[model samples]
Target: MKNTTLYKKFFVAINGSNSEQRPLSIALSGGVDSVVLLHLCYTLREQMPGWVIEAIYIDHGLSVDSDSWRAFCQRLCESLSIDFKTASVEVKAKARHSLEAQARDARYAALDSLAMANSMIVLGQHGDDQLETFLLRLKRGSGLDGLASMRAQRILDSGRVCIRPLLNASREDIEAFARMFAIEHIEDHSNKDDRFDRNFLRNQVIPLFKSRFNGFLQSVLRSIELLQQQQSLIEELTLQDLQTCCSEQGQLDLQRLGALSQLRQANVVRSWLASFNEKMPSKVQLEQLLHQALTSKQDAQINIVMGKGCVKKHRGFLYFVIAQDPPQPCVDVALAPITLNDGRALIVEHGVGVRAPNNNERISVQFGLLSSKIRPRNKPGRNAVKHWLKEAGVPSWQRAHVPLIFYDEQLVQIVGYYFEHSMYVPQQGVRWEVVDGE
Candidate 1:
């Protein structure tokens, strides 16, 4: 591509729908691709007047030359009078997960924290990187969603926008732009190690493919676009299926879900997990989940480990409960919202539910009192809290999270489930609402 054409592409990407006037944070690695991207943004600065342009280098600290690369990026940014920042991340590798993936997750998290909100995080990934990603997913037996590859623009779960202006440009196009402008860049020595799948592809597999078929990359790009379109249709169908099978509390109704074909059932589950931003389960894990959901005994407890949470079944419904810190042992209850250490809050409102505590009474909320007994609104007598939880169909693992409201030393309310029979009022009462923290 010509210099002017490349500039126009960057301009259009930054000026795309719902993206105008947002600051740009370029992911600089002191490599040709990113260096060229920074140069383009710097040259096009006049076109995007009043927009902030900066470069951020994330040091994974895995390579011996990591410090030098950060220095290089800092100098380059200074030469162009752009803001420069660096962040170091610890890549915590887990079993069955690749180091690359761990580093990527850490890098993205750091960027999310350091970048300005409502701004764009520009990446320097090109068409060659897209081809490598498609092949990598194919090697892992990924379905259509994975094979669809990267997009020019996407919004992260954190609501920050990311754009890849170089996604459509070929590697040769970027190199030519760099050479024509005599731009200097550094290379990471780790790229020479074929132990990495991407390195192996770039050095051995892709060159042969390019030589064998002159338009191989273009053909793959076209296929990716078609797959993306097909994936979009599937997403729409999954959403429609979800409406029938998913409850307002984000629980999946097994009866409704099982009515669909096995393929549709899996599709709905994947979409359901995606709605909660949960990592997609592997094929084997997904099959096991479906099997347990369909054939397990009605009273049998079901708990499947997912990313940071567990999938549990209770009363014919499946819920994804993330692990969270337990709430404080006790908290004073008042008119203002009471925020818990965990991502939860209780808003006590004046409504028809439980009777307001008397002026002399000390109102507080407590957790984990399974042995305590209380009489539900119309119940004959007090029953153990554990029995009340079981009767209410609360999952065994989640029974401890139920917030108990105390009037002095007596249990008067189960925040979300019921009110004490003696404390219940028909006219004026305090109703409690639970607000989930993100």
Candidate 2:
């Protein structure tokens, strides 16, 4: 509870983090927790030799005082001689998502863009925050991973490392440290509103719980630690199961996955989705996915949509298909990169590809020409583009997006799939490739 003890605890946590070599970007919200963290890190700057401590404030533009909050954080950083930066983001609400969720997503996205590459992001979440998150997840019927709650240090899917030095520090200790240093911070008016679940818990539920049980927080913390250990073991086993059932193309082999128990099957599905950085489906949705995947007819087409993409089953393999806009037909062709409308790039390069276009020929790129025929090099004869794509195991929904390169009116190349047999050259020649857009 003493200021010195609090400082020592934070120092030990940060010093042992192994992020001393990297710059630290504090997610400063101009609140008590963050202000205290900033003060501690800045005061101990002499001890952390390699750390370049800075503060980044993300303005969600939701509150009228958002700019004032940013200015406050900037001034605080200036007083401490710490670098300060701000990013303003528009929080757009989406279906089946709360405003808090949207704002949180926007805030993190702004942080990711504003922070330096490979910089460690420092968040000022305390023990009370962790307990609130645990309760919220529990209310939503979260599993082991959710119950494990926040990690002191976690590497995000974007490969950015985030650390919480105050995770184990109690709110009381943080407030005491602030009072001891006479630290200044702004109180967000939204914190007083009980309509939000977290705010309600922090303002009402937690206080009552603490009053009734002095050691409740400590017991919950121990439970979370134990849950984290169990979740880590589960993740290890899930990876092994994934390796056995997932294909090189990132598709899960239904037969292999079905061999596992129903619970194991669900675990594998969840892990597979996570590997792709896709959002996890609800319990009902996940159950439906498994049922359709295992019981559907062999020739049945399964297309279930979730989180920026749809999942499809093809030949017993479950594939995650990112939603792409319809490809627009292009009339020009050159030995350069052509940006496609469907978030893909058509690159034409000289290699063991198709022969170069003649001076009299007009080259162009087209899409949705599945009815057209093209003779692939080394193949027996010309076949419909649709049939070629089928033989190549291209999903039906994606066939329309495949770029078709033509010399004048003749089909010469299928961009990525194959080159026209007549125009193909085994030696040095121009070839085409399709890649994800930047």
Candidate 3:
């Protein structure tokens, strides 16, 4: 196979003619697809003098042959005079996720950590991979976002752009290129394991389709392109709706979200979740979420856990809370300022009408004092800590995490809400205030 078209497409994808300089890192897996991609990119480095070419091999440690694959990648990179790096990652397959998915996640995480800012990380996924992803998502009843499959270019979490320059090329094209160039590559034995859904599709389903229908891959690609366009439109509309539905502190206004159509509501919710880089909910989970949002009573508390986080509805707003360990108990407050487990600091400052702790008084910071009462600086009467938090517009999810300054058994002040004015006279004195650290 001729390399002219592939080289041109790769060059354009990396913006080879651009005057700005940025490094390009190829994700090399010692596979034919990646080897051909690396070779093509290496051949173009002379034309794009501003670009730095490098290769990264991520060893998931799932197989005994991983070391040999890493060595192959290193030797290939050395032969091409390109910088080589290897990251060893542990693949922890949870009960809910497959080993393949876990390995992919670990590999991408390693690659993201190895990538630099403003660099382009090249992947070797081809047209067949895209088709498999689409079919898998379809079988799982995915929405437009999943059905659209992978994109040619996407911004990663490390501020690096991931580009699949070979997305339009087929696996046969890659294999032919590898043979024509005499590129040395290794085959992962796991690829032949049909127990994995993707492998099963590649070995059994896809071949059956190819045998029965001419140009089936091309037809699938055309459908994917159309679905991608439709998905893009939905995303644009969701962004516009999200502006109206977003509330303070990155929460979503449930009332505003409810005003939209059901499909629009799901789109906005998905868009909101993506803003925080949260994993997308499954079809059933999403349906349940929409049902809860649309039908649940206004006064009822709603909390639904999904992935590593949860969707919670409180006070007419929706919040995504990442599952985290309980906040550690606050430490004893001495004369110096102390920081809390939630990144808030307890500071002692000298001010008028401030109450200074006595020598015998036990000074400390505490959280979740629901029954505690405090007389705010300007308020008329003592109010419950929970009520004050609600009046101050603090969400229910964050109320328990609010740091409270206590002198012995009495709640002296609530951080960011009330400081007891009557605790001390108007003189040069010391008071405690909680400062936001994040």
Q: lDDT for each of the candidates?
A: 0.86, 0.87, 0.81
Candidate 1 wrong stretches, greater than 4 Å:
1-5, 17-19, 92-94, 324-326, 331-365, 375-377, 405-438
How do the residues 1-438 of candidate 2 rate in per-residue lDDT, one tens digit apiece? 224988888887887784446778889999999999898888677655556888999988889999899999999889888999998899887787799889887877788778886788889998999999999999998889999999999886677888898888889989988898788999999899999899999999999999999888888999999999999998999899999999887899999999999989999999999887889998999999999999998667999999878889887889898876668888856678888876788776777988888888888888888999998987898899999998898888888888888888899988778888888887789988888977
Q: Runs in model 2 with CA error above 4 Å?
A: 1-3, 92-95, 325-365, 374-383, 403-408, 412-438
Stretches of model 3 off by over 4 angstroms after superposition: 1-3, 16-21, 116-118, 193-195, 211-214, 323-337, 347-362, 375-384, 390-393, 424-431
- Flag the better candidate by lDDT, 2 or 3: 2
What is the lDDT, from 0 to 100, of the residue 44 in candidate 1? Answer: 66
Where is model 1 poorest over a 10-residue stretch in terms of lDDT?
1-10
Instruction: Check candidate 3 and list the clashing pairs.
Output: none
Model 3 scores a TM of 0.87
**Clash tally, candidates in order:** 0, 0, 0
Model 3 lowest lDDT segment of ten: 13-22
Alpha-carbon RMSD of each model: 3.4, 3.6, 3.2
* Best of the candidates, lDDT: 2
